[model samples]
Target: MIASDARLAINPNDKVLPSFSHMADAIVRMATKPDRRSGDLLLWSDTFASLRRLFIGVGAGALVGLMVGLNTAIFPGLRAMSRSFLTFLSIIPPLTLLPILFIAFGVGETAKVMLIFIGTVFVISRDLHLYVLQLPKEQITKALTLGASDLAVTYRIVLPQIMPRLIETTRLTLGGAWLFLIAAEMISATEGLGYRIGLVRRYLAMDVIIPYVLWITLLGFLLDWLLRLAVARLYPWYRTGKE
Candidate 1:
């Protein structure tokens, strides 16, 4: 009776209405079937925990990127110095620095955090410096004429205007940080997805390795999507071309 009613609602005389009703019935039957792995709550819990860690890592990266980017924009000389030093460091693979990091900081959380920070801060700072310098000259002139101090003008006018770009640079840096985490974890991690992957790789467990890679890739995608959503919400003025 419900199927007939739905068909009637769709079209009084359309022959396709019956086909639609059958499709709806099939969907209902599929929905009513019990999930075979209904008892695997532990699996779901572990998955959620892993996801939480990924989110935390991405958030930390974004915060570090934002601070570094802002510092670069405000202090061009510092940006130049950072660029030169970081460029030289980049020539040497981060994995090569692992031994030095371990010797200096030990195989601890500090070394891991520093590795992530080092991989991210330079690129974010450079992008931010370029974006800030590209701001309209007229905007700076107007702010100066209005008796605003250089710092005040930058903080109030310039920073607000370039916030969207800053958010974008942050998103980019967060992606880099994810890559860094894998390398950092490889150094001496006792735990973490990267460590798990390293352990599995020794035994040539392709099954475990594939799932770990997929999990991390999914996490990266989710973090990027969330950041994009945040940018749209916080800076509604930027207008994501979503008409």
Candidate 2:
């Protein structure tokens, strides 16, 4: 017979780390219960606020990046003018600008939104520019041969095709977008997912921290899924071409 192991028979209360069951219970309780300190549900409200900033920041960035990329690809003059500046901007660590942004924007919603925008715009623009350059030159020549004006070629041809690529680029940059959003919120926000996590860190609240982190991950996954579904539904040609 094997010797009985005392260590393996330790009481639950004696354990230093929580069991898997305890963690699961913590997550569930967190979802259902109001915050002890505030007597309010912080999760939903923080999630909404973070999401609002995310949408505004990312939406504006995507639109601007799309325009910059499309024009840079079509016009050599704009490419020459903007390429070096964009490259320089992309290389700068965006987090390093957080203090400046807070100073300039006064720690308001604008600062948080602008952090995400400035972090993501150059990356999306550069990626889209590269994608645009890879598109066959023959398509442009064909349009011109058929007497399509520059505007017609751009809007009627290039824009539609690049829509899928723009969505794809946006999806890819979302991780970084979340990072920037959280960083901004952590630095200067009264209530947000990041702010809550930062607020609870002093107390070593793993229960709240873990759940919030998981919620952020779930939100990111959902956004990526929605973007993918949009590409499939709105631009079937892009998906078929990939396959």
Candidate 3:
């Protein structure tokens, strides 16, 4: 009977080990396997696409900066009037112009692009004007002494020296352009990250909304990174501050 009891106890102990082993196996599987759906992957890809758009926005910002920079450098007298007018316009919340833009340019690409352009130009121009005025007179004088024409002096001497500062100014203006785009899209956009966010919000889809916000943030960051890289490449000498 004692031997029978010993065998029965052993049988129960054997079953307990397998049970523990199965539990351990389940825990390991849970730890190693990722719980992601196909939707997650699609979301990631869409985020990347949005990031590309943000980079495009940065390019737009750069163009706007270039135009404003050229205007301020070439025509200092007009700077004040342009600056004041643009400042007034910018202060009027970007969304407020939606109706006007929609009426004039319609709820199309033109209006959206114009909104970004208008939002960025004045501030960038103001920064560029200040930087131009602060440039060393000796550089301008040297260019003139070397038989450089007015246009040549402005392009070769003035522009090259301030190119780094102009890039920095563009970087700053990008934020404003981004803000304007989001507002403009929210006002009247059929497609875009901003539009997607607005749609999700209307439905109270917090999950989708959160991911879209992450997408926008990540895209903005990537654009800023690309701009910095471009600046480093285009103005390598400027990095040392010896230029």
Highest TM-score scorer = 2
Give the alpha carbon lDDT tens digit for every residue of 1-243 in model 1: 565568667786533324444545433432354436553232244345444444565556556655565656556686776756645554555556667887998987677776665665556556666777777888878889989887887678877877787677767766667676777666577666676667657866444555566667887888779878888899987765754
What does the lDDT read for residue 39 in candidate 3?
28
How are the candidates ranked when ordered by lDDT, highest leading? 2, 3, 1
What's the CA error at residue 71 for candidate 2, in Å?
Answer: 0.8
Q: Against the correct fold, how does model 2 do in TM-score?
A: 0.88
1-62: candidate 2 lDDT, tens digit per residue: 01112322465342334455555776677567897887766777788899999999999999
Better of 1 and 2 by lDDT: 2
- Give the total clashing residue pairs for model 1: 0
**What is the clash count for each candidate, in the order shown?**
0, 0, 0
Q: Estimate the TM-score for candidate 3.
A: 0.70
Off by over 4 Å in 2: 1-16, 20-30, 34-39, 241-243
Poorly placed runs, candidate 3 (over 4 Å): 1-61, 74-93, 241-243
lDDT scores in order: 0.64, 0.85, 0.64
User: What are the candidates' C-alpha RMSDs?
Assistant: 12.1, 4.0, 12.9
Local distance difference test, candidate 3: 0.64
TM-score of every candidate: 0.68, 0.88, 0.70
